[model samples]
Target: MTPTSEAELAELISAATTPFAIRGGGTRVLNADDGPILDTTGMSGISLYEPGALTVVAGSGTPVQEIANALKAENQRLAFEPPNLNDALGTSGESTIGGVAASNASGPRRIAVGACRDFMLGVRFVDGAGNIVKNGGRVMKNVTGYDLVKLMSSAHGTLGVLSEVSLKVLPNVEFQVSLRLADLSAQQAIDAMSSALGSPFEVSGAARDADGSVLLRFEGFEASVRYRAESLMKNLAAFGAIEQIEDQETCEALWSDIRDARAFAKGQGDLWRISVKPSDAPEFLEQVQPSKTLLDWGGGLIWAELPSGTDIRAKMTVAGHATLMRAGTDNFAKLGRFHPEPTPLAKISADLRARFDPKGLFNPGLMGDLS
Candidate 1:
């Protein structure tokens, strides 16, 4: 069923007796055999954009590229830098705003301004029972009741179908620069990234590629960005000779690669997005030992690409969940996708799903057996 309007969507949901798989742009890591599909692509376009207020309200199926173009015209952007997995996922449909929110997809700059959930101000969604629910406000001072806007995010449509979302935008930085510290090992790169992040240089992006090269980004006015770049180089002198990447085109291209996980595009092994305490990454990497990896989010997020048929959890000794981001059907079925939480936490998650979707109809069991 394709829903072109919220009212129509609610009516469809209210009338349906069988389970339905939710779809928005249909470009995510999804399994198609769940149930009848409810596609939201029929509903598209930005409803309201208050650039002066740094806010935008768009229909759930509005293409992310469309919103990005609109924001670029006003020198504003989604601060969290949501990822576009078109290439990585090998999916043709463009990612939608609602889809991005539902997955809480964040890129390299997530280390700076936070995540997709952090910028979400308000949301309009239809729950499993077909009831329209709205939470939060258009501005940052929303301090009432539960923060369902955040709860719905990263839920992968297990709770509701987002019809509309209002997000807090941010102004573009006047200038930006990256410092590439080469010839360092993984641990040394993490150490440099940690030190840079802990310092007052305002490092906006940090990552260590599989080849052991580290990158640190700074953004602000031209003068400030340059000063910080030089100062950061001096501070990180112990690591190695630092190379400055002030060429706007070069910096943008490199970051775009890291942001999109271009290294793990197609033909790569199964990809996992692991989140752990930034300081604990070095220890975790020593255990999992993936074939290729990308250390990002100042070491808090580790994008590991392991060989096929490998069980990531078996090698995991750290205190973090491993998300099976990309893999073939056989691999996905063999190795569970999401990390199964401890018994206590699993019960809490199960209870939340039951409260929102008693029938276990929304993307049932993909995030774990909430059913």
Candidate 2:
């Protein structure tokens, strides 16, 4: 079922008796239980764009690439740098901005700028009860009352079906430079990334490839980028000799591959995205010893690929959460996709769900058993 307007979407949900599997672009594959599918692609378009003000408001179904092109024309961009995971996930569809917010997706730049929720100024969504709700606004200061905007950002379409979204943007940089340190061990890679991030070089991207190479990215005006790159090289000399990648196309392709974790795109094994303190990452890797791993966010975000049916959570001593990003259908049902929330947080989640979805008609079991 595809609704072209918010009113039509509300009416459909209001009249529905069964659960709905809300889909936006269908890029992030999930093990959705059987139910009627509600695709949001029909409800897409840019409603408002103010380049000077650095804001863009679009329908929930607007394609992210479309938004990117528009912002690029204005010398602006979605600073959060949301990743397009279609290739990695093996899904075929446009990557909608709504899906980005729904999953709270962010890329390598998240370490410096922020996550998707930080740039989200406002949102319009239809609650599971079929009521249209609005929060925040086109401008940043327009926030009032409870901050449901943040809540809805990562609710995974369980709290509501996003209809529209307002986001803050940043100007594009004039130049970009990448520094690489080759053949570092896991700890060495983490240390090198940490040292580079700690330096005053404005390291926008810090990641370690599965092949033990650490990449550091800095972007700004040409002069500023050059100055910072030189400073980073000198400051990080203790780690190793830094190789500079100054070619624009080459640097961009490197970051894009890192942003999407393209290494595990077609490999065998279930993919797990682990979030841990940057300092604890080396320990976590030592314990899990996954077949493949990619480190991002200065080692705070770890992507590991393990053999199927391996419970990563059980082998953990580090204080972090591991989310199952790729797995078989039955495994999703048996092992779950998200980490179990603590009792208190679970209660709060249950209360929110009860309030927003009184009929429990939205995507059921999408976030695992919240009963």
> Which 10 consecutive positions of candidate 2 have the poorest summed lDDT?
139-148
Per-residue alpha-carbon lDDT of model 2 for 329-371, expressed as tens digits? 8877777888878888888898888899888887877765557
Model 1, range 1-371, lDDT digits (tens) per residue? 88899999888877777777888987876664667888988778999999988999999999999999999999998888888776766777888999999999899998888999988888998887889988877766763433788899889888988999889899987889999988787788889999999889999999987677898999889999999889888899998788998899899888888888777777467888899988888888889888888888988888888887788888888788888878888777777778888989888889898988776678777777874
Q: Which predicted model would earn the best TM-score?
A: 2
Q: Where is the poorest 10-residue window by lDDT in model 1? A: 138-147
Instruction: Give each prediction's root-mean-square deviation over alpha carbons.
Output: 1.4, 1.1
Taking all chains together, the TM-score of candidate 1 against the true structure is 0.96
lDDT, candidate 2, equals 0.89
Best by lDDT: 2
Local distance difference test, each candidate: 0.85, 0.89
Pairs clashing in candidate 2? Answer: none
List candidate 2 segments past 4 Å from native. Answer: 32-34
